[model samples]
Target chain A: AQSVTQPDIHITVSEGASLELRCNYSYGATPYLFWYVQSPGQGLQLLLKYFSGDTLVQGIKGFEAEFKRSQSSFNLRKPSVHWSDAAEYFCAVGVFGNKLVFGAGTILRVKS
Target chain B: EAGVTQFPSHSVIEKGQTVTLRCDPISGHDNLYWYRRVMGKEIKFLLHFVKESKQDESGMPNNRFLAERTGGTYSTLKVQPAELEDSGVYFCASSQTGLGSSYEQYFGPGTRLTVT
Candidate 1:
């Protein structure tokens, strides 16, 4: 079965500090990976996606993710954390134009 | 372009009552999908529609749930005799047809359903 794993249930970072949220996936084939963020009382927003080609993919709001095929991981990173960036982040995987299978999300908290 | 929209940002109902949720996809999007996130669980796919046609519905949990898309426009999901376990945030998403980059799905603000 295809599955997405987000290891960190909750993470805390000082505002302006570097941040990284880990994700791992299990799929039988090359997976279409995605990162989505949901702010409080808001819809999920696409952060970035990796279909193929470049291992490192850039997304909106100064976020980026690198797909490590060997590790079956697509970890999200940001150079600096902003208070507004605090939200629930999810990692998802899809195959062959199918619906996405999401991971248990990780909650990020930015402290001033 | 307007984003996908779902009706009734929140709904509270008795366990045995019937409830219907509606979704209007982004204009011109050919693919529509339904998903739900139960408490302490990952968001899971409920079903997918390709222009009013049920493309995939393997994710639907049980027989009491029914989904329909008429004339390939808007869609509705109805739950009869709802149960407490059904309480969750229901999300609808839409995307254009094609491969690779075109497959990116745009999501709507979900409807929170609470079964009392």
Candidate 2:
């Protein structure tokens, strides 16, 4: 079965500190990976996506993700943590061009 | 370009009742999808519609959930005889069709449903 695993349930980091949320997926084939963020009372927003080529993908809000095929991981990273960046992050894999299968999600807590 | 939108940002109802949620995808988008998140858990896929047609309904939890797209325009999901387990935030997303891998879904604010 194809599934996404986000190992961390909650993470806390000081403001200006670097952040990395781990994500590993189990899929049978090369999959379309994506990172989405849902801020408080807001809709899910696309952080970054990886279809193919150039493993490292950049997205909005100073966020970036690298797709490691060998590891079956597409972890999300940010050089600096912002208070506004604290939200629930989800890792998803698109299958058959029809729908998305999402991970359990990681909650980031930015502490000042 | 307006993003996808869902109606009744929040709905509170008793169990065994009916609730119908609506979604209006971004204009010109050919694909619309429904998802549900229970108590802030993983957002699970519910179904998919391609221009008024059901492309995939495998994700639907049970037959109590009925989704429809009118004339390939806006869409609605009706959950009849709601159960306590059905309480969650229902989300709707939309995307355009592309040749290769162009499945970027734009989501809505979501409708929070509370069943008692």
Candidate 3:
């Protein structure tokens, strides 16, 4: 079955440090990859998406993700972490038409 | 433009009671989806509605859950005889375009359901 996996359940980083969140997906064909972030009391916001073309996609809030087909991965990255960046991030793959298969999100903690 | 909006940010109800969650998509969006995330679990797709039609409901758990989008406007999800295991954050999302690069879905603040 097609599925998405976010290996790290939680990650902590000091403010201004680089951040990377890993995501792996298993799919028969090239899937539509996406990154979504959810704050404590907010909705899931679209960070970035990879449908076709441009392996690296830019999203809102200074977030970007690279889709590596060979590795079957779409990892989210940010140059510097902000205290406001502490949130739960989800990686999802669109399959079977328009539905999205999501990974068990990873929670990020930004330390001072 | 207004984003997707869900009613009742949180709901706490008895196990056997029925609760209904409502979602109003962006004014022109025709595609709406329902998802649920159990505590410490991945968010799972519950169903999808294209306009007023049931596009896909393969992920719906059982018959106890009924979802409807009347007149392709706002949608509603009603859980009858809610179970203890039904406690989770229920999210509703809407996308403007269909099966294209514009498939980016806009999500609403999820309705947190707690069945006691």
RMSD of each: 0.9, 1.0, 0.9
CAPRI-wise, candidate 3 is medium
Best by DockQ: 3
Candidate 1 chain B: worst 10 consecutive residues by lDDT? Answer: B96-105
- Which DockQ values do the candidates obtain, in the order shown? 0.74, 0.71, 0.77
| Shift in Å, residue B47, candidate 2 | 0.6
Candidate 3 fraction of reference contacts recovered: 0.75
| Local accuracy by lDDT, each model | 0.94, 0.93, 0.94
**Compared with the true structure, what per-residue lDDT tens digits does model 3 show for residues B1-116?**
99999999999999999999999999999889999999999999999999999999998899989999999999999999899999999999999775654367889999999999
Cα lDDT tens digits, model 2, A20-80, are: 9999999898889999999999999989899989999999999999999899999999999
lDDT by residue (tens digit), candidate 2, B51-104 = 999998898999999999999999999999899999999999999888433479
Chain A TM-scores, all candidates? 0.98, 0.98, 0.98
| Candidate 2 ranges with C-alpha deviation above 4 Å | B100-102
A40 Cα displacement, candidate 1 (Å): 0.4
**Any runs in candidate 3 off by more than 4 Å, and if so which?**
none
Clashing pairs in 3: none
Query: Candidate 1's residue-wise lDDT over A34-112, tens digit each?
Result: 9999999999999999999999999999999999999999999999999999999999998655689999999999999
For candidate 2, give the DockQ.
0.71
Worst 10 residues of 2 chain A by lDDT: A92-101
